[model samples]
Target chain A: AQTVTQSQPEMSVQEAETVTLSCTYDTSENNYYLFWYKQPPSRQMILVIRQEAYKQQNATENRFSVNFQKAAKSFSLKISDSQLGDTAMYFCAFESFGNEKLTFGTGTRLTIIP
Target chain B: EPEVTQTPSHQVTQMGQEVILRCVPISNHLYFYWYRQILGQKVEFLVSFYNNEISEKSEIFDDQFSVERPDGSNFTLKIRSTKLEDSAMYFCASSDFDSGGPYNEQFFGPGTRLTVL
Candidate 1:
């Protein structure tokens, strides 16, 4: 079974500042995908970004990027020039190749302070 | 852009009562899934459905729980006898299977908060 871990329970950053949310997972599978999802006050799960394990280059989506270290079993999300809208509960998820189930971390509540 | 949508944004029921959560997935999606999250807990996968049958299920999906796609657009999750522990946010998701590239990106719906008192 794959297990994802997000050590941080909460985080706060000033608006326009950069923030990084850490996540690690234990999986025996060689091929998989990692994802970051955000849940705001509306409580809707929104996909922030995703990274393929096979890709050496990290995934970047505008201000949201990921640092994926396959060997270390680490996938971290970085939010640059963060805005107030970025404040939400962030969760890290893992899905192995050919598997439909997604394992998710507990989540880190992030707040962007003005 | 298409997205998954769930009905009864919030439901409150007594323990031992039956509860059904409904969802409408993307029109073109081929796969459907159900997940739940207890308040302050991580999301947990319950079941995945494809071709009108269950493709995968987790330990959390016990005999008391069932899923059905009764019609063309509606996917439903039914808890036969709800327990207090069953109170949580139920989420419905769907994905399209593309043979080329790992394109099984699941789109999530705004979850329904189920409260069993």
Candidate 2:
């Protein structure tokens, strides 16, 4: 079994500033995938980004990026030039190799104060 | 890009009654999944379906829960007897094996909010 943890229950940031959300995992599998998902007030969860365990290079998607430390079991999401729309509930997820089921963390509610 | 879709944005049902949530996964997708999130809780996996059968399911997916693809397009999750704990936002997702192999991504639907009273 695998577990994901998001220590910060909530976070706040100002517009145009950057905010990073932290996540850690406990997994025995060497090969797996990590992901960040954002759920807005509408309850629609959208994929923010994903990182492959085998690839040492962190995954980046436009203003969203990740700092993946495989050895340390840390994968943090960095939102650059954050906008008000970026305020939402962020979740960290883990998926093992060849597995489609995702295990999610409690979540971090992020607020972008204008 | 094609996306997964779920019907009935919200549903209000009575406890002990049956409720079936419908989903239409991406047309070309081979894998379909179900997950649920209680208010302020983490999203929990329910079940995964492929090849017209369930490939994997979590402990939460008990005998009361069942899944089916009655047609070529619609995939459904049926709860025989809804409990208060069954009240949650259910999400449907789909993915394929063609995008440079599996685990590329799973596109999620808007989700269905089930309220059991």
Candidate 3:
């Protein structure tokens, strides 16, 4: 069984600043994938970024990046130069190769203050 | 430009009524999935379909929940007896391949909001 945990329930950041959302997971599988998904007020689940366990390089999508520490079982999402559009409920997900199920963290409500 | 699509953006059904959520995965994708999110909870996987059969499912998908790919393109989730707890937003997603790669991104649809009373 795999599980994802997001310790932070809510976080706020001023526009143009940076914010980091923490996430941890328990998985015995060595090879897997980590993902960050954003759900705005519209309630649409949008993929933010994804990191492959085999690759040590953290995944980056513009202002969004991941700090993946495989040994620590930690994968955190960092949003730089945050904007109002970035305000949403962010969820951390875990999925392994050949596995379709995605175990998700509780989620972190992020608010970008002007 | 390809994307997954789900029908019945919003559904209001009485308790114990059967509700069917429909989805059309990306045309070229082989893997399909159904995920649900309660009002303030994280998205939970319900089931995954591949090769014309169920590859995996979560505990939440009990005997009352069933999935079918009746035809070649549409994937459906049928809840035999809806409960208040079943009211949530259901999302459909699909991936081109399961292998980890840049293109393995799962495209999601707008989702269907099921409201049970």
Candidate 4:
């Protein structure tokens, strides 16, 4: 079984600044996928970004990017130019090569200060 | 982009009563899944369905829980006897697959909050 851990339970960032949420995982599977999901006050879980294990190149989606360190089993999300709307609960997830089920981290509550 | 849709944003049910949650996944997706999140807890996987049968299930999904794709569009999860512990937000997701290929990214629906009293 794979376990994902989000070390930061809560984080705060000023508007227009950058913040990073950290996550680490334990998995023996060589191939897998990593994902970041955001749940705002509305409680809608939205996909923020994704990273393929085989891809060494980091994935960048507009203001959201991931620093995936496969060797160290770390995948952290970086939010740049944060806005008030960026405040939300962020979850890190892992999916094994053949599995469709996603195992998620505890989550980090991020607050963007205006 | 198409998305998964779940009905009845919230439900209140008495203990021992049967409750069914409904979802309509993306039209082209073939794999369906059910997940639950207790308030302030991490999301947990309940079950996964494909080819009109169950492909995977978690220990939490006991005999009381069952899933069925009754029609071409609707996927349903039925709990024969609801328990207080069953009260949580249930989310449905779906993914597209071809042949025997590994499952790809899953798209989630707005969860249904189930309150068992």
Candidate 5:
């Protein structure tokens, strides 16, 4: 069994500021994948970014990036130049290399103050 | 761009009644999945389907829950008897196996809010 943990329940950052959301997981499998998903007021699950365990290089998507620490089993998301639209519930997810199911963290409610 | 789509943005049903949530994944995608999120909780994976059969399922998916792909396009999740605890937002997701791997990025649908009273 695998479990993801997001210790922060809520966070707020001023518009244009940078913010980092922390995530950690407990898994016995060495090969897996990590993901960050955002859900806004509309209640839609949107994929923000993803990282594969085999790749040590972090994944970056425009304003979104991740700091993946394989040995520590930590994967955190960094939002640069945060906008009001970035305000949403962010979730950390884990998927084993060959498995189909994704185990998700509780989530961190992020608010971008304008 | 192609995306996964779910029908009936919201559904209101009574306890013990049956409810079917439908989704049309990307036409080229070969894998389909169903997940749920209780209010203020994390998203939970319920089941995954491929090649006309379920490839994986979580403990949360009990006999009360079932999934089917009756046609080439539509994938459905049927809850035989809804419980109050079943009230949650259900999401449909799909992904294709590329050279990268089967663990390719999964595209998610808007989700359907199911309210069991």
Candidate 6:
């Protein structure tokens, strides 16, 4: 069984600043994928960035980047130059290599204050 | 941009009644999936389907739940008997198998809010 945990229930950042949301997971599978998704009030899940366990390089998508520490079972999302539109519920997810099931963290409510 | 779409944005049903959720995945996507999120809880995987059959399913997708692709563009999930616990947001997702990549990215829909009273 695999599980994802987001320790921070809520976080806030001033506009143009940066924010980091923490996430950890428990999985025996050596090869897997980690992802960050954003869900606004509209309820649509938008992909932020993804990191492959086999690759040590962290994934970056514009302002969104990830720090994936495979050994520590930690994968955190960092949003740089945050904007008001970044206010949303962010989720960390895990999916084993070639598997369809995606285990998700409890989610972190992020608010970008202007 | 092509994206997954689900119908019946909101549904309110009585307990013990049958409810069917519909989804129209991206045209070229070969894989389809269903996920659910209870209020303020983590999203949970329900099932995955490919080639007109179920490839895998979670324990939550028990006998009471079933999935079908009755047409070229429509995929549906049927809940035989709804419980109060069924009140949640149901999401439809789709992906194209990335044979050469490390992992495939699943695109999610806006989600359907289902409330069982």
**Best candidate (score: DockQ):** 6
Give the range where candidate 2 chain A is weakest over 10 consecutive residues by summed lDDT: A38-47
Tens-digit per-residue lDDT, B20-98, candidate 6: 9999999888899999999989999999999999999998999999999999999999999999999999999999864
Worst lDDT window (10 residues) for model 1 chain B? B96-105
For model 3, how does the per-residue alpha-carbon lDDT over A39-103 read when each residue is reduced to its tens digit? 89877678999999999999999999999999999999999999999999999999886666788
Candidate 6: residue pairs that collide:
none
The list of candidate 5 runs beyond 4 A from truth reads B98-102
Q: What would the per-residue lDDT of candidate 4 be over residues B1-117, giving only the tens digit for each residue?
A: 788899889999999999999999999889999999999889999999999999999999999999999999999999999999999999998888544654367778989999999
TM-score of 2: 0.96
In candidate 3, which residue pairs get closer than 3 Å at backbone N, Cα or C atoms, i.e. clash?
A: none
Candidate 1, residues B1-117, lDDT tens digits: the string is: 888999999999999999999999999888999999999899999999999999999999999999999999999999999999999999999988643558468889999999999
Better of 4 and 6 by TM-score: 6
Error of 5 at B48 (Å): 0.4
lDDT of 5 at B113: 94
Please state the error at residue A52 of candidate 4 in Å. Answer: 1.2
lDDT of 2 by residue, A43-90 (tens): 778889999999999999999999999999999999999999998999
| Candidate 2 vs 4: which has more DockQ | 2
Q: What does candidate 5's lDDT look like per residue over A56-83, in tens digits?
A: 9999999999999999999999999999
Kindly give the stretch of ten consecutive residues in candidate 1 chain A with the minimal lDDT sum: A39-48
Expressed as tens digits, the lDDT of each residue in B1-117 for candidate 2 is 787899999999999999999999999998999999999889999999999999999999999999999999999999999999999999998888556684758888999999999
DockQ of each: 0.79, 0.79, 0.57, 0.65, 0.78, 0.90
Each candidate's fnat, listed in order, reads 0.72, 0.81, 0.53, 0.53, 0.81, 0.92
**Clash-forming residue pairs, model 2:** none
lDDT of 1 by residue, A1-114 (tens): 999999999999999999999999999988999999998988878888999899999999999999999999999999999999999999999999888888999999999999
Go through the candidates in order and give each one's C-alpha lDDT: 0.94, 0.94, 0.90, 0.93, 0.94, 0.93
Tell me model 2's lDDT, rounded to 2 decimals.
0.94
**CA lDDT of A69 in candidate 2?**
99
